[model samples]
Target: MQQSEVTESNDQAALDAEALQQEIAAAGAEEREAVFRAAVRAQAADVLDHTTIDDDSNFLEQGITSLKALELTRNLMSLTDVEIPLVAIIEHPTPRDLAAYINEAYAAERG
Candidate 1:
């Protein structure tokens, strides 16, 4: 990738991070999970360069390469300012599962 492309990607990632935070924060307790799942779906789609991804679709099965998994992990960490390991993608393997972990992290951050 060219320098300009890298910079653009970084800027877009920053914007996505901010949007993810806002989306989750705006949700009430009962809606938090749904909101988080949506955010996770968006992140996965962004990292995979897809327009949309099913919440329960296995990431690896969807062709998420190691590099894309790393990008997804970074995006999730940025979204919540939480430290998530790279293996999280393998363990969670789906937006729904990852959302649960991310929501837990967000709640912990609030505590």
Candidate 2:
């Protein structure tokens, strides 16, 4: 193959690798989010059983108080081995937001 063709092939390979990495990261994020949501549901089972918990639903509105949030954060930390600040639950009130935050923090810690 010509030198230019070889370079183009290398570039394509790099792009493919990058794309695959992104897809993997996205899949991992989705899985983490699912797990986080499950944990939240489990923790709030008493209150959530009668209500639907969507991604955007407010945890406070669902009866998750500050003390409950602390307990939930502790549970998450034990499950994920990531240190989540107490304020994180307040800042990222919903499971979706908290999951994203935890995933990002986990990735950063790994890096």
Candidate 3:
């Protein structure tokens, strides 16, 4: 890639990081990323490679493969052991959406 492309990618990554941090904070404990947690951070880091993802980004449209999805699912399961339906992720592609779904699921499980 050209120098300009590299610069753009870096800017996008920064934006993504900021968006993610805001989302995590807004989600609170139930949906928070727990950055100190290795597994959660690793999962977030893995997905961060797809810098094109925005709050409204479509994971499927952006070529998020089944394997990557599975990996994310596995990582999440390791943390919460909640069996999130694959279709849920397919339907809610953005981090904010996924965070909302996970929070709801966690609440339902608790109550």
Candidate 4:
């Protein structure tokens, strides 16, 4: 192949890589938010029947129990397709924080 043709191919390959990275990032973000929201809702439901809370709501302060925590983790595992550490759930008790943690884990696992 000609040198110029090889350089053009390399350039095309770089652009393709950049595009793939952007697409992966976008999909990861969307999946992360979706998983987090689903987990939060599941946690809330486990704690309170027919109740709704904001994304930033504090589950612990609102009486979220250990059993409910496990339930939420289970729900998140189903949604995220990633193995969530029990420690992470315990460390990040609030819904928003836990969601962010879950997002990171999901993205890392994908990477």
- Which candidate number would show the highest TM-score if scored against the true structure? 1
Over the stretch 1-111, how does candidate 4's per-residue lDDT look in tens digits?
999999998887566546544443566586646656655666566555536766767767767678776766765565455678767666876777777777787677877
Q: What is the C-alpha RMSD of each candidate to the true structure, in Å?
A: 2.5, 15.4, 9.5, 14.7
Residue ranges of candidate 1 with Cα displaced over 4 Å: 1-16
lDDT of 2: 0.69
Query: Would you list the rank order by lDDT, best first?
Result: 1, 2, 4, 3
**Model 1: per-residue lDDT, tens digit, 1-111?**
999999999998788778867867888755787877887798899788889999899999889999999988887787767778898889999999988887777788888
Top model by lDDT, which number? 1
- Looking at model 2, the pairs that clash are none
TM-score of each: 0.77, 0.61, 0.54, 0.62
For model 4, the stretches where C-alpha displacement exceeds 4 angstroms are 1-31
- Look at candidate 1 and tell me the lDDT of residue 31: 78
Identify the runs in model 2 with alpha carbons over 4 angstroms from their true place. 1-27, 46-52
